[model samples]
Target chain A: MTDPKTQTGSRQDEFEFFEESNALWWITLAPTTWAVHFVLAYGGTAVWCAKFGETQGVTVARLSIAGLTVLALGFIGWLGWRSVRRWKPRQNDMEDLSHPEGRHEFLGHAAFLLCIISAIGVVYVAMPALFITTCR
Target chain B: MIRSLAGSGRRLVAMALMMALAGCAGRQSALSPAGEDASWLHDLWIVMLVGAVILWTALNGLFFFVTRVRPNDWPERHANRLIIGGGVIFPTVLVGTLLAYGLSMMPHMRADGDGLVVKVRAEEWWWRVEYWPAGATAPIVTANEIRLPTGQRTELLLDANKYIHSFWVPALGGKMDMFPGRETRMTLRPETPGVYRGQCAEFCGPSHALMAFEAVILTPGDFAAWLEAEAAPAAPPATPEAQRGQTLFRDEGCGACHAVRGTEFDGLVGPDLTHLASRQSLGAGIMEVTREDLTDWIAHTRDIKPEVAMPAYDWLEAAELADLAAYLEGLK
Candidate 1:
């Protein structure tokens, strides 16, 4: 059997490397998608409205908004899927207070929850395009 | 204790009822919806209020149950489920549905450009109203009072000459901003024939609180008659005293700022006074349109409305002031 100390040292090294490399950026992946959706929706509508008066820019602006919404939803959904995969708990993760991978598991669980929320937010944000009649 | 609790509850219910009833009593009340747009807004407000009450009650009930009824520690999985379901799913669904419903109603609130159009310019402390009748070369210029045909959708082209202002007639429709160099539009279709009050919804200056106007909705025939009368020049001042007042109006340099059609005082710096006497109020609805009020406004405008653009004519003799008031009041 491998030495227990060596195993612990390797695990510590992995966690440190993960931290240094900023591998946990997936934690913010969901919110980042939301931010992108918000900016594009508002900015696209404003630019379209300014370029083509209220009455004319309806079609292109709305189509673009719809496309962006779908893209954001898909991206967040993929992130959620990855988070779910990462959140597979070890046998004693719940009961083992000193579990080495507990932090990673908790981060994965939080990221999954946030991704679900962000997906819902993306859908909610996109709802304006579905109903708002342009330049009315 | 039970009796006292019941009494307190009854009092609370009574207070709530009174508060709700108060919303319906004001002339400038969105709750007292007199048009289709205002009705939609009122209905939306009620829905949001109901949603808020439900959320408040549910959250407080949950809090009470968790703290007082069952104080045992919940399992981590159950807590997590509650957080995700309540914090994430519930609010997202609720707000999403509201946003969709609200956005869907936006088109109906806007005009189809199928009705009469009125151009309104917001100045420092007054409104310049121009009525665009069908097939008219020049818009019939008026001020302060807006006359509309009942049951007809009328569009207002709103602009600001100086600072930004907002046009709002709460009983009729939502507010639209008046931005400098940009014209915004809003439509109103009043269902009833009555006088409604409108106020400058945006704070623009020191006298913003006093900037108000009247919307007089009338039958089609009455509105046409009013428009015809409004389009005409003021009848020449009749009495010798009135004539003297007219001469004084010209001599006092009032012609530099005020315009009385059919007279030499064709100034555009101030409100048109061709039919000023016909209006319901003066100083933009701050005072009743009367000889006494007009005299007071002319003599002590600064005292009455602080920081208004019109300077006080306190130097005019009492008799001259009376003549000016009579001449103005006789224009109708």
Candidate 2:
């Protein structure tokens, strides 16, 4: 088998034109954004209620949540768009996925799908802000 | 004589289920709602249960058809669509819709309360409930029992003195937690007039399960009269035994923790015993408020509620115990 990452001294397919740097980081970036937003939303609300008491700073909390949600979804959307445009499917029956081209497509498709799911999660986490007006 | 084994097993299972379900209509069951919030929760539960049953039947029907009736694999032309639609799109849409529906009801579940305010402090293994009437300067204090009026929204401001405890009355509404420095609010608008049991939903200490209280939802007129009476002084002892028992009560130094109004025993560490005789139960709803239970509780305080700060009076003779019990029972 050829080297999976570099593909040195190996025959390359015509579709193998990928040149994204630090490619594996994109797979984890979307989920990490979701986690950060979740923690900040929960911890911020709890601290705000404990210190200021009954709905004292609810307006500010809601605004911060809305802004954070938009920022997170925008970053994930960019990653998803980039991955979808660069994605390439397997061509024939005899193609071995151990080749560099097949591996690249698999990673790209996986990151793209993860971005979609993470975006949904962020949306669900933020939906409560629309209904729950109080600090509770 | 028993019939076939399978038939006997089915009959036994049916009888067991019926016996289990018979316990659902009581003071603690959420299914038997006495308030508006609990009624809505019961309705939401029914809808969810029916939706789950329908989904289960449909999924199982598809499984049986695919596995048993159609053993041959379908053409590859339709394979990708079937895989994507069944595994991904169907679940995403279903869960998303359900989540949206659930979130939409969040604000209404904890709606604002505009009626009378009743502040409750959750102490170790007991409740210190105070009612703030419309034009009162100080709160009317009580313990181990809560009373609310019907046809109006009653707001409950919950807090804790030491450990984290939860105040839950299933027949009235949902549970609310109480922290030492923080306060949580919940509103209950009880429409039915009856007695219900409230318990500490969070496990706080050694006798957490034994920490419970009785809640009475009364008509507006009856509640007004009851509140007026609760604010007054304790009635004087009527019989000779009760009078001597009251003297023994003060001599034994029981007044250090428990308070009895209209007397010199003005303590604040434990429950108020001014109206002890009128209450439904004693020792935080562990036993009936009868002469026998009162005597046992006063003698065996530590045994009745473990880790409680109340001291035991086991050194007192049987006649002294009986007189003290009689005194407490006559404080109505």
Candidate 3:
């Protein structure tokens, strides 16, 4: 016969897995943003330097922005990985410990919302300014 | 593990197949060099590619063998020492040898003694080349096309008049950047008697993609004749259509973007049309100077080339277009 506590734990584990999976997907935002910024900044600067043959103050600014994106993305990936790894075990052992469902659920929801909002912002605000043609 | 080896082998095979396909396709681009320096560069690249293939195969083979043959939990706790020693020693030695070899090749690439000098200035969409011979007080300023005598070593002093750009001709040598405030030198000898096309390697603006030039290497006699022809003034048009076109050229403000020597047309914004009839292609090798192509281009340069600086002359009648085309073609 299965223990009632173990059954409850399995249910709680399922819920936590759902939330953590959502959070992990949400964490993809950090990497996506970083990658886009990196491509734009570095690629744009390279083009600018090549075309004009002069490195102005603006080129330095763009390159620095690219570097920062790399750093930020790497840090975010590390943090997200740590969070997900910790969450896996915590979800598995949920009913054994005190019910701490509220905090994990809230954070996961927040991350999901943030990701959606940022993605929308990128689509609406950034792409047009960066890619539209005016070459002469 | 076996899958990985298979995958790498597949990649190698795929690369080889692609190279074979490229060879068979016969899409010989016009911009490639047929000269000695270019051939040397190409050979060196092939050698390096072969070396890379061998190295990659050996490294991957070693990795595959080690992973496959050895158990995961081997008792030998540390192979880190050997790895660290090899990581430091081999790269240091290899890189040093490469640097030395590259340094040895540099002097030959940079001609030291007296050579033909061509000053190249990069604008937004065109190249202005000034050829100055040894002991000459004046230099011949030409646009788009650079004619050089075959077997003559020429040193190009390259710089951008407005922006950063790179000068490259695949058959001549590698690329060198043209900085706004700085000048970079490149040496090349066109040993072959053929046209070598080149483009602005750096992205400058919208028209950057279309920016192109050519090096027309000719026999000694032909080159001399070309030089003499270029030094002479613009000749009068022979045909009635050409005469009408010349009048149209004056009336229609064609003088705004181009310059034809010994005429009132003195606009420096575009290519010098002084010897327009002499060139094989119009608008810096964009298209052939055929009657229909010239009419289409002159009628609507913007339509043909969206980002071209030249405005369209769509207002002209068909008769006018033909006359203009005839006149421009007779500018030789």
lDDT of 3 at B128: 74
lDDT of 2 at B234: 90
What digit string (tens of lDDT, one per residue) describes model 3 on residues B1-332?
99999999999999999987676322123234456567667656655666567556755665675589653753332444434334434444444444444444554675632556889888767777777877778876668777777777777889987778888777667778999989888777767788777778898877777777777878879987998888677888889999999999999888987888888888988777887778767766677778998999999888777677788999999999999999988888
Residue pairs in clash, model 2: none
lDDT of each: 0.85, 0.83, 0.68
Worst 10 residues of 2 chain B by lDDT: B76-85
User: On residues B1-332, what C-alpha lDDT tens digit does candidate 2 reach at each position?
Assistant: 46688899999999999988877688898889999988877776776776667667766776776689886887754655665676566666666666666677667777777558899998888998889876668988889999999988888999999999999999999899999999888999999999899999999999899999999999999999999899898988888889889899888887888888888988889988998888888988889988899889989999989998988899988888888999999877
Give chain B TM-scores in order: 0.93, 0.92, 0.84
Top DockQ hit: 1
User: How do the residues B88-190 of candidate 1 rate in per-residue lDDT, one tens digit apiece?
Assistant: 6676677766777778788788656455789999987889999997666789999998888877888899999999999999888899999999988888888
In candidate 2, which residue ranges exceed 4 Å CA deviation?
A1-21, A44-57, A89-101, B1-6, B52-77
- Winner by lDDT: 1
Question: Runs in model 1 with CA error above 4 Å?
Answer: A1-16, A19-21, A89-100, B1-20, B75-81
lDDT of 1 by residue, A1-136 (tens): 9999999999999977787345378798899989889999888888888889455857787888899988898888888887766666544345442455566666677788888778877777777778776644
Give the Cα error of residue B264 in candidate 3, in Å: 2.7
Q: Model 1 interface RMSD, in angstroms? A: 1.8
Range of the 10 consecutive residues with the lowest summed lDDT in candidate 1 chain B: B107-116
TM-score of each: 0.92, 0.88, 0.63
